[model samples]
Target: MKFSQWIGFTILAFCVYILWNIRQLLLLLFTAAIIANFLNHGVQLLQRIGMKRGSAVLSSILLSLIVLSGFFLIIIPPFAEQLPELFKLVSLGLDQLILTIKDFILRLDPELIKALPNSQQVVEQLEPLIQIIAGQGLSVFYTTLGIPLTLLLLFALTLMLLVNPSAYRQGFIRLFPSFYRKKIDHILTECDRSLQGKLTRILFKMVMITMLSFIGLSLLGMRLTLAQSMLAGILTFIPNIGPVLSLIPPVAIALLENPWKSLSVFVLYIIFYLVISIIESKFVAPLLIENRKSILPAVTLLAQVFFGISFGVLGFFLALPLALVAQVWLKEVLVKDILDQWKSNYNYSHQEFTSELKKK
Candidate 1:
């Protein structure tokens, strides 16, 4: 390789090393960027209505605050009321289930019934694990409380970006070689368009699914339908595992009400989710994405699990978008340039071989 090419490769390698080392910071910044983009869209809409940019940004921020407050107001009370009751019911039902299992065991083999551990003793043995699980749950709740702070920082950064997006654009453009800057800019624009389109459509679909789930569960007389449905919809972004998580609350409640009812509710939930997911995977997502490429759903979900484990709840929420960004970078920069070069080299050697064969 030429001296300049070697130097460029070294610099790129160094940058990659730095990025790997500071991935947490990068994640936070990426999340901020997404929030900024959403805020910018809202501000732009207000601007189209003849509002001044400053006024538009301020109004957008205020509107966001109102929406968030309203969401919390709607969600919290029902959750608080249902959680304790749900836990009590779960404990009682578990005890009853154990008794039923023991009775069946006695009927099948009298000796096996004597071998079974007392239910209370088993529960005592499991207490530490249960406490650990509850601790993790509380940590999630604490992380959620940080959302307001995150939003504040995001809004402040967004206002600055909205006020002068060109400054950041120019800075980013300057990071590339002069020959590639314009191409990079165009790629960035395409990415923004793709991300924005997909995000909006996906959010809308999730909301629709949530509402439908709520209505169905309510009609079925399930407890905490609203909260459960809302949670299910929100977690839908997590792909394969999301619907399963959503099913737990309703199924647990049903089990508490009656084992047979729980089995029926489980079947109904499975059917409902199957139909919804099929429509989403086959039609909705494809239409929204249109001919645009995206990361594999499996890769996206795996990334979510990895990030959620490492960084907790914030990571979970940001995982899919981060995966999407990584996919775009890999496709545009790595595959297009590096892999295409390798392909060209292969083609050249093949053509030379064919020419030599003809001469032979």
Candidate 2:
């Protein structure tokens, strides 16, 4: 309407355009922030036990490094060695499965036998899509192309943020007006808490899934059970979809080991999934997170699409947590404060004017 208003709009649009252009860097920063937050909790814990801040931070970093080292060392080497055999077993399993299906169809109806899709053709069609999805997911953590550099930067940024979080927190608060600084600080705290709770929930699922899968797979006499279970646990980070994918390799191996055992392995996974889901829903979630505002499956899928598009593979992996953080901020700052207050403020003003008129 006014020149100042037009100028303000232009500036705001320009800022958004700038932000869009640098989104990748922003995402990397966000990833760093999430890592920092996770580490910060460890730092806080150490501090509570009389450790100094610097030592706590360094200890947290080293502890993370140790954990990661253990994962790669213990998990990767065995998986790498078994990979070829695993693939062969999987192929055999698929072939056997197809044959079994064909035989079943032939018994039920001769016509249905001719209609059965060729497994080779289906695999060929799916191969490229699977490669792309897997590649992208892998890129989130490491790509041979960017391996050390990207990860180095990520860790470096995380350490910097973790080292002096209050400075960054205050810097962010200072962006707002003096009067609103306190409110912004409060909102940031809420986001921190929300993110921490989400991280805790995911970690719980990972540990439980890993332990259960190991025990169940071992009982089934599967090869490489520990590595497979570890993979399953890590895959739990991907939410509903990941655990399902994790089942494929083991199920195929089970089938190759013993066709009958395939069914047993499958049943075990289902039972464990049900058990884990119930515990999370009934106890872990409630204890960790105050607001159990469910993340709908549809919304989760949409988050994958949006983040995957915006940030690529890395975005896809971080989508759930990013969505969670965004949800908290939007609810607290936008919906609760801005949108919800509008009508109430309007009603209050109207009532005040009415009172003045009656007094007059």
Candidate 3:
């Protein structure tokens, strides 16, 4: 390559390296952006009803704070009190389950029992590996011991962004060449709309799941039903694997009391989740987000692994949102414009683009 070309390549590589080093900060900023977007919708709604921008933003922030405070006040105290009992129940449940399994094995033929490998020996061999993995995971979390500070920074940033979102949006647009600024602005608008729709759908699903789980657990007379349901609801944000993890605590506690009750709890969770899933797929999503493409489960899992490794637990949680945003940009800029229908000039006018975007 020519010397100028080599210099350009070197500059690009250096920029990438710098970005990689500060990726965590970027993720936090992205999170703030998502929060700002969610809040911005509320601001816009208030504006439509004749409220000024500042008042609208303030009202939205106050509303969010009120909801959060109410949730913590209602849920945290009881959950904290019951935590010890919950752990004790889990231990008893495991013991009872093991005994039941042993009794079943004893009824099997002597030769069949003899052929079975020793579970204790297998566990012993796996213990060190499990401990190592767990230690590494804990260490990663320890490295993020300042997460509260990070969260504070994020909240502050979101507030600042909310106060003058147009300034930031315009600043971002100004970063591009003058000719491409319109297209970039259009793309950003699309991304914001997509993220808004995704979050709305998720929040709706979470509320539904929490209510259904709570109702089901109450009917079954399960202890800690509120805490269990809330946990289930929050974890439902994680997609495919979340519902299974959510079932473990309640099912284990129930199993300690009655095997039949344990089975019923499991069935109840499955039915509730299945119903929610069907409604979400069939109705809720189509009504909420008609324009955005769904993120595939496999892609979501891959994003989780990548973000989890790169940014730890917080990253793992934000993986879906990050992936969703990335998918939007990739589809609009890379796939649609560059790959699928690359055209030179083609009389691309702002009005024509706006018309096309509206149709989309």
List the global CA lDDT of all models.
0.72, 0.82, 0.81
Of 2 and 3, the candidate ahead on TM-score is: 2
What lDDT score goes with residue 120 in model 2?
Answer: 76
What alpha-carbon RMSD in Å does predicted model 2 have with respect to the real structure?
A: 6.1
What does candidate 1's lDDT look like per residue over 1-360, in tens digits?
999999999999999999866655555667667777767877888889899988987788788889988877987688667767766665665666666678789889999877778967888997775555444434533554365665566556666776676688789899889999987887677667667766775686578668877888888888767667777787776656666776666666676778888788778877776776687777677555332676677897788766665555566766767667667777778888787666447788999999999999
Which ten-residue region of model 2 has the weakest summed lDDT? 136-145
> What local lDDT does model 2 show for residue 332?
83
Per-residue alpha-carbon lDDT of candidate 3 for residues 1-360, written as tens digits (9 for 90 to 100): 999999999999999999987776777788898899888988999999999998999999999999989978998889778777777877687777767777788887556666665658778997775555444434533455465776688899999999999999999999878998998888887787778778787888789989998898898899888778888888888867777778888888898778999999989888887887798878877776434578898998888777777766667778888888788889878998888886665566877898999999
Q: Each model's TM-score, in the order given?
A: 0.71, 0.82, 0.81
Residue 36's lDDT in candidate 3: 91
Specify the highest-lDDT model's number: 2
Better-scoring candidate (TM-score), 1 or 2 = 2
Q: lDDT order of candidates, best first?
A: 2, 3, 1
Q: How far in Å is the alpha carbon of 308 misplaced in model 3?
A: 0.9
